[model samples]
Target: MMATVRNPARDAVAFVGVGTTPYLRDAGGKSATALACDAARTAIEDAGVDLADIDGICGSSVPTVSVQAALGLPAVTWWSNSSLPFSLLVIEAMNAVFSGACTTVLVYHSSLRGAGGSKTAAADPFRVHNASDAHGHNAAMTAESPSGTYGYCAWAQRYLDTYGVGRDALGLVAINGRANAARNPHALFREPLSMEQYLGARMIREPLCVLDMDPPVDAGDAFVLTTAERARDLGHRPVLLHAATSGRTDRPFADQLEDYTISGKEIVAWRLWEKSDVALSDVDVFFPYDGFSIMALSWVEAVGYCQPGEAGPFLAKHWSAGENRVLIDGRVPINTHGGSLSEGATQGAGHFREAVTQLRGDAGERQVPGAATALVTPGGFLWNATGFVLRGG
Candidate 1:
């Protein structure tokens, strides 16, 4: 028998405030650092905390010094740039708070993809050029297609081939996101998406139309974390950080993954349950990162909401019903504030904000009734996945 690893810091920290800059196709002339500062200020104001009170900061894809100076913090006791997945950045902030290294911490993310900058560009300096760079890479040579669409296209095709599922199964995921986005005033795309539009849309990659992929945008999102006791004394309702855990699969490489259908989210989900008192049944809302429709579908199964290969049918039945099963009043409301797919892409930070808002009853039109518990899964690619369980305090 194996012993379970429990998080002793469970519920020790709470997200007191969340903020975001306008999700825009182009940020005009604003730099990513400036956008991050705007979001940080908003979060601090929402938390009712003075800028001087923030002793720690964590971020991904942005400079800590720039944000620190821009915010005019007196001094930073602890600061780091994880550059890891955005969800892991949240866990790092929680760990800093739990260790008494800082009292109030801010975690933020910003992207200039719309400005023609991308993660791949930033990582290029660190990557060693291979033959595939000069010659085009193929889908079968998974690890070699770092900058191409073949990797994702291959995954989508594999899922379809293995389950004998149609492309519509993936289309439903996009439709659900668009429906939720229609209710969000801040979402970039508010127009209603129809099944006909989805099926007829131009294909970016085989089996994946334009709507199935996440659009790149310039945006920033920030969150404030403090001790639960302190959070309760702050301006807004504190959403308890019940659990935060991340894990990787044995096969970390894209081309070498043992099983394409099995996302390592199962490992994250099991670990989250082991650390929290709440169960999946008690969850009132869900916010899974929708970098791609298939990624969201993988999380749906990884979290044990349905068995593997069942998400296609489950979504088809629930997503299309007249009752709007994926809405806030429906059986299990998901991505109530839209998602990266429909909402602006703030990496995974937008998902964090949605969870906090839903838990606080601050999501205006998409607010779930009595949403006391929320589950947020942030995942990308095959193995890197993290889950956060939040409860209203």
Candidate 2:
């Protein structure tokens, strides 16, 4: 039986402010708590709201209590610790606001991976030494080790094999992201990456090169959400949350995935579209997670932008022709802030920030002209997927 689809609680809540600390390779002794506070304070100020007005807080990776203490908030009536992919935090914040549990809410993400504070183990999943075996490793070891790339590489290979594409198609994704990053001052890698450079990059895993991965960094991103009426009374323009949805596949592990080429985004995208008036064609900006270049392609296909396994040709036709193709003014502007691939990884919050900025017409150099709607997917790894459709109000 098909479930009844209902429109999202449209305009019930909206994002009024977005903020982030300067992404850095190392925060130079700054703790995740401190970074979260910095971003939260900035967001609070950006929204023209006082700290006391923040009745709710939502985050993952960093504790909400620490953030509240660091910012010295009077009290928070609602708080939640959302898990992975970052988009869940946004949805949680919206839920809190709509339930009247809180008038204004803060959602944030902070990571200290690049500061050597939370370093991944050196285990390589592809190679099994006498002392260590990939299949026998515990869940903690698997999640905390750099060896995870092995699974992503496996998916990349299967994608190529299934679609009859080559490594060059993946190169196009990297090239497009780097090109956008070159124009963003806050991006970690701002230099223009040519196809020659992308193809020649060091191989991290077969078919997946160094350029295909997002570098871990120490940074924080935050946003303020409130009722649309309250948002209008605040400083910045409100970016309405038209729809949001999240889901995970029963096959959680990479080896157990039902389809190597598919990420769980298709599930979220289906619900997101069913719950919103907006369609893919109505999106002026698209921000699909690019923790890995292939992940972005997976999302592109999952969201019905193109047929499954055809994202390579679609990108080649639309993203290959320099600035005139997918830039801010192109047919489909994407990842205007360069995404996690180029914009220092903020655990996908950077994508949300850019989406709000573009909708507000404040993305100075990377602004998508007349951008009224945006679709953002913060999912990869064929699990724990979340998506949102936002409209400018």
Candidate 3:
């Protein structure tokens, strides 16, 4: 017999508040702990709640207990310091709220350049020998050939060779993100990135250039989640997380996995679609994680946006010349906050933050008109694929 499908937690929890520190090279000499605390404090205030109201905390790259104490959160019934990419932290907090383990959860992510990130990062007294890959700084991935990351360069080469396409296929992705970043005040690299610039950027890997990767920054993003009912009572308009799931292939090792034929994101999209009660047509905005430009293209194709190996043409067709960005079908905008490429890598935190901001109609210059549904596909292939649909209305 086929297994039963159930989604009792659908829309049970909602995001009521979000806090993002300015994307910066250095966070005014503050430590990761300080950055987390600052974001957490802003999130609490944004939710219009007292510190005691936070009964749970979830994050990466920083200790949950330290954050709790720094913010003077009385006693969290649930706490976890999970892995990167941000979606895992959201899932954990959402489950805690739905399972009655916690009423309110503070979800946060901090981006810092550890010693492995760059020569500057290595020279910083604060980052000496940190060697931790909290988020894809692109430097560590280059220096060490990190697993999930460098693995994509090979895939990019294959995608190009398979499609017989030029560098413009991937160059457009970077250009589009930088164009959108121009309008986002919070983005770090807002300068116009033309196709020529993307093509000429330093080649870190054979097929992947520096512009194709995500740069590191000292930044923080936080969100306040609670029961949907309670969320309506909070300050900002609640963005309901309708469905969430992550996927991976049977092949656990990145090197041993089959490529193109099976993408973890396709599995995630299938499950998310079933639980979300909607399809691509219903989506008002799309936020595909862009830690690497190829990942965004992968999502564009993986989630039925187009056939396999066609994201280049798909993006080109959706290109808005006047706006200098991709406006899907001349309506839905992808990664309005510039994405990981220009927003600075919070892994996937920037995508979620921009989605919520768009949904709340607070995105100002980058807002998608009447955006009510947001599809956020975060993380990437080989065991990190994760995504969720948010309903704003």
Candidate 2 per-residue lDDT, tens place, 1-393, comes to: 157987647768999988889888766767777778888888988999998899999988677988888788798999998776678889889989998999899999887653122333123221112211211234356444544466678889988998899888788777777778877888888778778888899997788988898877768889999999899998788999999988566776766778854446767877888898878888898998888888888878888878878888878767637472354224677787888888876668899999999999999988877989999988675666788899999
If scored against the real structure, what TM-score would every candidate get? 0.90, 0.90, 0.96
lDDT (tens digit, per residue) of candidate 3 on 250-339:
874556667765868878877777777878999999999888888999999888899888999999999999988899999988888888
List CA RMSD, all candidates. 4.9, 5.0, 2.1
**Going through the candidates in order, what is the number of backbone clashes in each?**
0, 0, 0
lDDT of each: 0.78, 0.79, 0.85
Quote the lDDT for 68 in model 1.
90
Clashing pairs in 2: none
Model 2 gets an lDDT of 0.79
Off by over 4 Å in 1: 1-3, 114-149, 323-329
Q: Which residue ranges in model 2 land beyond 4 Å of their true spot?
A: 114-148, 261-263, 324-329
Output the lDDT of residue 363, model 1.
83
lDDT of 1 by residue, 1-393 (tens): 156686889899999978889988666656778778889989888999988889999988677888998888888799988754578889999999999999899888876553123455334432222111211232345544643245566787888888888888887777788888888888898787777898999887788878877776667889999999899789898999999988677776656667865546777877888888988888888887787788888888888778877788877666636734364224677787668788866657888888888889898888888889999998654656899899998
Winner by lDDT: 3
